[model samples]
Target: MRDLVAPALASLVCLAILIGLGVWQLERKAWKEALIDRIVARSRIDPPAPLPAFDAFDPARDEFERVRVHGRFLNDKETLVHGLAPGDTPGRALQGYYVITPLRLDDGRIVLVNRGFVPTELKEVARRAAGQVEGEATVTGMLRQSEVRAMFVPAPNPQTGEWFNRDVPGIAAAKGLATAGPSGVAPYLIEADQTPNPGGWPKGGQLRVDLPNNHLQYAFTWFGLALCLVGVFTAFALRRLRGETGNGETGENPASATATPPRP
Candidate 1:
């Protein structure tokens, strides 16, 4: 029994770690489900609402809220964000730039609007000339929070002014909207809806809600691995305990060592 202590302790420690991982994944599953539900519910909202006060905006409450705004597009100041979207034909994907154009609101305050995707070839404004809507316009879209740059995702390229994430503050500063009067620019962005553009180049309605809910599967995997670990440890402990007994797995009696094999 004394000899089994160290191995038993190690086995128990490993078992605890496996179980901890399983529990953590289960927690993640619940969190992911709640997040997905909130976003989906927002998408189904019937009528778009008015924009909130600049200072009143909160990421928690404001995100995914469908909003309507009366504005004029600052076409010349369009910033490109790298994106991929499904093309006219299914399955084949198109690499493009999501045209982040500033919309000067009726009251003079500005907000960044993701007009939609335009392929690399249409990058030159001249190529997709007609899509740029002139004069005042009414736009409806879902409010989106500025994307936080992840650890592994590369930062925007200063040389070419290329931005990958929907970083509202940085884009606003770059476009000189950071101090566009006292109101300046809204911190959040508006992902435009599928209302067609003039030339249909910068396609609208590109909001994608793809939150992968693999946490439940991950929890199952972790729990399954923990069970396997328990089974293996149980077998090891049984073998170790058997070895400690006088009649071990081989069933060779310890007394035979001294009895000299019956003088065969």
Candidate 2:
């Protein structure tokens, strides 16, 4: 009994921690599922709603809500976000840049639109001269929040026109974009839909709503390890307790002393 005390207590503590981690993963799974559903639902709305006032939009609640805005493209002010072409592209996937062009609204405010992916070969604006839209245009797409910079992501250099993430404010400031109305540039970005451009370059419709959800698999792994831990500890305790009991019995009934071992 004494020999099992330390291991028993330690096993109990380990069990608690393992179970806690499993529960946390389950919670994360539920959250990710809900978010994916929301994105799908919002993006499918017919005739996207008109853009609301800058102050009226809520980043926490309005992400992925499809909206339409009328504006003119500032084509020369394009910023290229380094990324890979979508797997659904016409041919083999190629390394490319997402042409993030600014749309100046009638109200004089600027909204950055992720026009879509363009291959490295057509990187120069001159190469794809036909796609550079002119005059007033209407863009219908999903609203998205800005991406956060991770530790490993390289910061954008002033000289380079490339970026790693969809950082709204950072791009706006660098491109010298602002608004005629209050709040300056819009807080969020508009991920344009797959509407064809005149010259068929800088293809539209590049929003990725679905994200990877593997929390369930991770939860199973943790729980399985915890079960193995219990089985091992149980076998150890049983063997140890049985050995101690047998030693005691043999010591009391030694062959030389018979039953007079403890009478003194």
Per-candidate TM-scores read 0.87, 0.86
lDDT of 2 by residue, 1-264 (tens): 797899899999999999899999999999999988987888887878777567677776788889999989998889999878656657767788888899988987888899988989998888998988899999999998778978999888747776888898889888887732355788788989989987998888876776999999989988998999899998877777666454445233455664546775
Q: Give each model's clash number.
A: 2, 3
Worst 10 residues of 2 by lDDT: 244-253
Candidate 1 Cα lDDT to native: 0.84
Q: Each candidate's lDDT (Cα)?
A: 0.84, 0.84
Please report the TM-score between candidate 1 and the true structure. Answer: 0.87
lDDT for position 84 in model 2: 82
**lDDT, candidate 1, 5-37, per-residue tens:** 887788788878878888998999899889888
